[model samples]
Target: MPETARIRNVAVVGHRGTGKTSLVEALLFQSGAINRLGAVEAGTTISDADEDEHKRQLSIALSLTHATWQERKLNLVDIPGDPSFQGELRTAARVVEGLLVTVSGVMGVEVGTSRAWRLGDELGLARVVFVNMLDRERADFFRTLEQLRSQLSPQCVAVHIPIGTEHELTGIVDVLHMCAYASPEGAKEGEPGPIPDDIADIAAEYREKLLDAVVETDEALMERYLEGQELDAHEVAAALKAAVTKGEVFPVACGVATKNLGTHAVLDLLVEGVPSPAKKGSPIDVDGASTAVFVFKTVADPFAGRINLFRVLKGRVTAETTLVNLRGKGKERLGSLLELQGKEHKPALDYAEGDIGGVAKLKEAQTGDLLVDKEVAIEVPDFGFPEPVMSFAITPKTKGDEEKVATSIRRLAEEDQTLHLRRDQQTGEEILSGMSQMHVEVALERAKRRFGVDIELHPPRVPYRETIRREARAHGRYKKQTGGRGQFGDCHIVVSPFEEGEYEFVDKIVGGVIPQSYRPAVNKGIQEAMHHGELAGAPVQGVRVQLVDGSYHTVDSSEMAFKIAGSMAWKDAYMNADPVLLEPIMELEASVPDDVV
Candidate 1:
């Protein structure tokens, strides 16, 4: 097991089209994890290995990949920037202690930037900003830096400045080292050199600002700086890590990710500035010192039953380590403990405390489930999912494939907590819901591709109900004299709004006006009328029907005649009583940053 100081679990988050994945690729390539860099346009990147992602050209799910920088393992979880896939974003936030927030150099501080920053604040996560895509048209690093300061936080200080503008961009100025690091087009890493004269003065200014921010986090450093004593890079870096972990400072780095410019500088900052899990992770009870794994994400693999990616919260876990699932209280052996490189699984020795790892084929382990050793006990953290915003009714395209469709939906929902399958009580249709319409569509598409079950999406039918407003009375006389033993029935009824309940029928008959045996027929008829209301043909609600005075032929007043009379009378009274239609409403609360709005 690696010491807690060597492990750094970070989530790469930003808006769509901000080169989050591209930056991750550059980092991996610079660290020698991959020999070649893969472009997102070609869909050859390891992080985005799914076919659906290739088709959409956007991340619909989070991907886990790691790189080694100076013998320190950096577990990089690349999360989708799109708001529609916020579920994945939240999932990544739950397990990681730091965030590598990517900002588009051209677009500056966008909606996604604000959202990610606020999320970091919400979780008290240490944040590092990368101003990516500086090689694109109209990309400005200084302007984006100002936006980061004004929009995100005043503590957003730059540790590096870009060497050139769009198209002419070649390198970055490492403000902390007071030097320049340039990378030629297609280079794997940037080499440090003397800072350009044109940007030297500006780099010094940013360096001074960085020192100012870093020293404030440490009283001793501040006092030393106040006494005119110079602080070296190492002193500032150590203080910067504490500041970043406490969210008192945010260090900004610049890069053209596709060209791999400033890749090594970013990695160096990540290792030097980001906090180890021990500083940022939740405090653990030393008395309950035993292995515990918190499963944060689960991927449903066809060949492998379930791939649960977990964070070792308390102690180390390795292959064949049997742990008790907190949910099911069942023993689950770590059969295939592996570290993930996107879809590829590499065998892992063990995941130390606060380190993330994957284990395939746990019996009932799932997202948000904590598995602890039998000797250890802990409460599972609640990583609540976003309520599905859009819903649609889905049915199997082919008949008698209901079981297959339902099974596919169930399995899909298991993998994605945001995807939901529910049956509408009023419409009697299977409803599929997700964060957005596209979210639902992509899940359904995956169900088709993975489970071999095809389903058709229909607009979710509105569960409208019906009710009466006013009190009204009516009479119905059904008299048929054909030949012998004809049908003769007479009844009166009043339909009114029932304040307390959904539906009620009262028989107010006296002196055998309507026979006792046939009175139940009156109630049955009114109930049948309640099923189909008068307004939109929906089920009537909060209706009270009263069977008042009525005459019936002793011989021909059978249950059938009275039933028809009651039905006719109730229909007339319902129409006379002001009827209204009601639809179900959902109350949703959204936590959106003002800048994003």
Candidate 2:
């Protein structure tokens, strides 16, 4: 078993195609966690296994993979950076203790880069930036570095300097150690090499900047640095770790993910430079007194049932352990704990605090559920994802596929929080809402592929309401002549506007003109009429109906007769009371292109 303190839960995030996934593959391969490195473009990478992801060549969900590098278990999560799939990034962010935010040297500071950085800041997660794909033509490390410093944070200082230029990218100098790792990715075939001469001056300059931040953490080091005394590599390493733990500095690391340049150096930093859970802070609260475990995602598999991906925030969770799901308000039994490799689940018997795991067949579990011991209950803070801005009206193409559509949509909603489905009340349309047009399109595609359900989508309809502009009185009389008996009833109602959302009915008939016993029947009839609107056929709200006068025969005027009379009178009053159509206007907040605006 790996030491719980030695475990590092880090998520890699940035804009798409920044080599974030490739970095994880390289880390796992070089660490011997996998026999061979898988390429993302070839769709052979372990973490990019979803058909939708492979087809689009873009990750649609969070992928968790693990590897042991130098006896330290690194739980790496590669999160999709697209705004449409941002819920996945938020899910991964809620669990990981640190963030390895990747930046493409060519793009420098991008919209996604800022977004990932903001997410990390919101979670208070320790962060390290890797300027990746430096081997690509036009990849500018120094330009990206300057942009990061200007935009991300001034504290984002480089600790390692790239020794060669783009396309000629070779290795990096560990400014803290004054030693060079020959591999551009880190740790070549044999022992580490000396600093490359070409970038020695650049390395020295960054070394001073790193020391300036690190020395502040220790009084002795501060004095030595003030006196212009050079600290040894080990001292600098210890101070850098302490500074990073305290968030005084975020040491920037650079690498070429495909060429394996600084990948091993990053692993070394995780083991030797990152802080343990104990040093970081307290265990996350479960409900009241118990430890908290948040299930950030749920993956549905037809053959395997479901895999609930969770982050153990406080205590250890073992197989067969029963826990409370605050979201479901029910107790769930953990069948088995597993580690995820993209969509695949590897069974495990135990999971410790701050580590991510998948519990198979958690019948009552869903994404955003806080699982804890039943005796102690606590709410986990949830991530804020963008609300869906567009909607689609969808229906099953065939009667046989109706149930399949519902089931598939429910599963899709579980996988992507921003995807929502509901029956629109006004138009009676089955509406699907998502972040964008593409989001809904992909949802339909997934439904067909996963559940074998075909659906047709249409534009959603707007809801409209009806209201009265002027007060009016109405009287309805219903009389029935049957061969054996007869029915008779009469009612007088005054229709008027109340405060919006306030619906009231008062029995104002005096001297029992309409018997008190039958007045309830009259009000019930009017309320029922209000549900299916009088004008534009929408639910009527915020109106008042008063029973001012009515007449009834105890034997002839039954409840049914009174009900009919009330409906007739209300509809009569609604049509003649200056009724007008009121369209339902939904408050919208969206970020669109300035040009579109």
Q: Backbone clashes in each candidate structure, one number apiece? A: 1, 11
lDDT of 1 at 543: 83
Show the lowest summed lDDT stretch of 10 residues, model 1. Answer: 280-289
TM-score for each candidate, following the candidate numbering: 0.86, 0.82
The best candidate in terms of TM-score? 1
Candidate 2: residue 463 lDDT (0-100) = 76
Flag regions of model 2 displaced more than 4 Å. Answer: 135-152, 161-173, 178-203, 217-220, 281-283, 286-294, 301-305, 312-339, 343-354, 359-387, 411-418, 468-502, 506-515, 545-562, 576-597
Across residues 60-145, which tens digit of lDDT does each residue of candidate 1 receive?
A: 78999998898888999999998788888888888888899999999998888888888889878888999998988999999999
The residue ranges of model 1 lying beyond 4 angstroms of the native Cα positions read: 282-289, 302-305, 375-378, 469-531, 541-571, 583-597
- Model 2, 26-103: lDDT tens digits are 888778877777788899887887788888888877888988877778888988877778778877777777888889
